[model samples]
Target: MSDTAAAEAPSPSVRSLLIMAVPAILVGVGSALVLWLLDLMSEGLQHILWTTLPQSFGATEATPWWIFTVLTVTGAAVGLVIWSVPGHAGPDSATTELVEAPLRPGVLPGLLLATVIGLAGGVSLGPENPIIAVNSALAVALLARFVKAIPLPLAMMLASSATIGALFGTPIAAALLFTGAVAAAKGGGALWDKLFLPVAAAGAGAVTMHLLGGKALSFQVTPIDQTDGWMLLWGLLVAAASALIGILLAWALPYVHRGFHALRNPLLISLAGGVVLGLLGMWGGPMTLFKGLDETTELLRHPGDYSAGQLALFAGVKVLALLVAAAAGFRGGRIFPAVFIGVALGVLAHVLFPGIPLSLAIACGCLGIVLAATRDGWIAIFLGAALVGDPVVLPMLCIIVLPVWLMVTKAPELVVHAQPESAAAKA
Candidate 1:
């Protein structure tokens, strides 16, 4: 065709989406499998560490000293892996952007190992980042061999969407999380059109999770009695306070990270991190350890079980643990820890003011911390409402985000921004 004729042709007909549908679905399913596998491996290892091994040792419950020893040893193992393993166990988790270039094929195994070790060893982070990176890398490598027409960027999106969907047990979370980024990109198309494949992949991923009996990230909070204008104001205060707390951590995270970096030895820094984390775990109890998924449920299952002081201690120590874990070079994401902190904070709110509904307080607490950590208002609101599994909480979270956004807008992000040379080195 002539140049004008080709230029005038619309880019991929709107109805031609079927061409990419199969690939998207396949990528989503593949991503979900990887996520499931990671969960299984981590949980199996944790079972041994927390249960079988302790039973073998004749302990009924893991003592604080046991917890301390386990964490310290886990840290040393991770440090050794990073020190001797190829790919340096992938990039430093503290400095890597959430979504970046797909990792080299050779680097994926080390990354996977480090992630599993972190999860099983009670590292205070979620599987979000590593799973996404792993899936992205695998998707790109797999697609290039079989489906060369699919672009790398689109492969990245499909993989990311799939992993996110599987992680949360829904495509809605994935869609909502990426909506902002998609809308902001330069393109000549409807937003939904751009989101079609991602949504397809996400739907498949969510379905895969259901098929595999993957745990959904949800809570069974009591339904709100009746939302009111007063509730909105109350939510605003709660969310703002929580966001401020998160922001304070965000500000301090970099300095602490650098302080650890000053040691200039991955083994020592990570070991020290593990030791500090062990002490924190000893002080805070088991609730503050690991990624916050199961612990969040534990908190909700017995909301009144913890006293005001214990609740406060849980929140503070979890935040500090999260900071130390990330700063000290563990491979994980902030969302789970943030969710745990939010839960503790919400419980604290209830303790301080008994009148507030438990569900609402939890939602607001999640809202503030999520908003601050992600620096994304929409995600924060989604997480808040999703955590409680209540649609009624959405409007209140929406209203509360307005204030939370203002507080976090100027605050430093939870990630440490590396210098150009360091960034290149990481890549």
Candidate 2:
């Protein structure tokens, strides 16, 4: 039906609400399950794909460049397919969009296709984006196909809540992320009142992931001495620095994605950027290619593996890589990559200030930058704690978020979200 036709026949708020929600819960569970299957198959897929590819291709962990080449080619091919599909080409995801747009069906397919291409194809991205959209889309589909008597408001509630739940694996975080967006979108009153449904949906999503036997998301931080009052102080400093970097990145996104209109064709621009990135990867090794989340895991597991100089270089390189990725027309995110950059900066800061805990410094930079970039404190709080594997950082992150939030919340623009998708596609 046409949008006008649909609008004239709008489902009653109460009735539509119910229609949208049932599927949300179902979608959440389904999304978590799909994500689990993908994760489980990832290593095996990587191994098989790597074994078959030629060596003189690109960079990867342990595997040769040829593996990355195969992956890259496949991703582009997938992108071509998504470009040809009807409806929204899925979403650009993780948890953010769950809160951004609730009923975008087209976005879901586009995102799912993109993420599968990103992961299975070898271009660096994550399941979170596709997970959020697919799960939500599934919820809407279920409601429409089965539950015919609900209000759109309730359905919208269910759709959003289920997505939030599926993405965060915590109803509380899912609800918070969802409600926070609502609150931000419309400034005021009883935000908590709107949170319960989404939280419940989050629970469904989390339970589903568990049933699928996926590892719960958690971070690892070496035990830190609480006596280190100076750590928090240094955290404040790191937070400030990270805030600046995040803002700079956010600001740079529009221009970088556009390549100042110097580069017009997205695929060509992306491929060109990819080639440059590939060259850089050739020198920087596997750590230089792909999204840097795996590198963050490596850093936590073996902080000693990096010296101050190496960390500094890594930090600079990641920032550059993210800029290039944005400019290249690839569909991925900026946060987890920021995680690597933040840690690199934090490690360097720790080396400069021995009294400050390296872990604490990382917490500040990562969390602070995310806050500045997204202008959402609670989400950043959850992400940072999860990344660092430290709960203590939560309270501290909350505290640090205050000043940084004040500095950047005025406009409350998302670096990537601020730009149009075509800009992103081209960037």
Candidate 3:
């Protein structure tokens, strides 16, 4: 322990980095498995509801009455579970953000059940929040038990990176999402030092997701070979309009949530919410139900299959569906549904302005809505480019997002918050 020897020895940062590398990879693999299981559970249930039941009754997938009945029952079931179950099925989503403190280990089961049922029963929600919560909670508990040297915050960050990576089928997207936060940390060292473990975890998660044959968010987008100045202008207009629409929905979310909560009973409130969602599903047809991932693919595969008016209706109904699903007692995330609405809007815009490139139009549409809803510009742009699977769209989307971000920078996010336990219980 000579002074010279000590000075040359590995620093705490280096030591922490070494300790976390392998463990972070393991966490990523574990998180990806959890996501895969959730996808299977929900998709299986969807098959039953959309295919099996319809076949049994000699009707098409998700008949209007069937959609109504399933959603109503789903709301009741979720409400009952949240009302009487232990841990209250984790926290109310309205009270939480895309990232939050991990829940107690005991709470994960109820949360899992609620989320699976919501996804399965065609609720307009995504698995992002619940899956991340579950993984973060588990990672924290494990780290505390076996690797106390790893900080809880670090463990949580790795878990989030893993889940996000698996969700989008890439570590780059996860890295982009966390870039701002990582850079904001109070440290003078290289930024890569902080991002190393998160990126490792994200890479592992992405590889595992690919191994499991998980689908990435992609559409058959036409590649953009040339950038037009007028196209950029059109993008700004489309993006701005979409952002404004998202802001309106954001403003309405709290009031709508309050109206549902005023029922005072989780059962009645959830049931009423379910009925409303059911009617919306019926009116909007099957496209409006479930998280928008699969439906978005279906919508984009054959753009000519739908008309401008139909796309607009679909977009409007989906926005309402997303709000209701989040404000109601459902345990899920809004990002996927929001993406769907954005895509629908983009499709509608393209239909109106035939001169506009479909890829640019859709990317701008997503940029506007996602920027407004999530208020995360990096994620907004990532989503827009990811959907198109085009590198050229990146710069175009980046430019389009500038105006959209300005429009939404001062606006409120689409989340609801109220008095603690009472709101949590009712919501």
- Pairs with backbone N, CA or C atoms under 3 Å apart (clashes), candidate 1: none
Local accuracy of candidate 3 as per-residue lDDT tens digits, 352-405? 998888888888888898899889999999998888877877887778887777
TM-scores for all predictions: 0.95, 0.78, 0.95
What tens digits encode model 2's per-residue C-alpha lDDT throughout 201-245? 667878886666554435677746574466667788888887787
lDDT of 1 by residue, 243-271 (tens): 88999999999999989877766777789
Clashing pairs in 3: none
As a whole number from 0 to 100, the lDDT of residue 79 in candidate 1 is 79
lDDT score, residue 203, model 1? 94
- lDDT for every model? 0.86, 0.59, 0.86
Pitting candidate 1 against candidate 2, the one with the higher lDDT is 1
TM-score for candidate 2: 0.78
Better of 2 and 3 by TM-score: 3
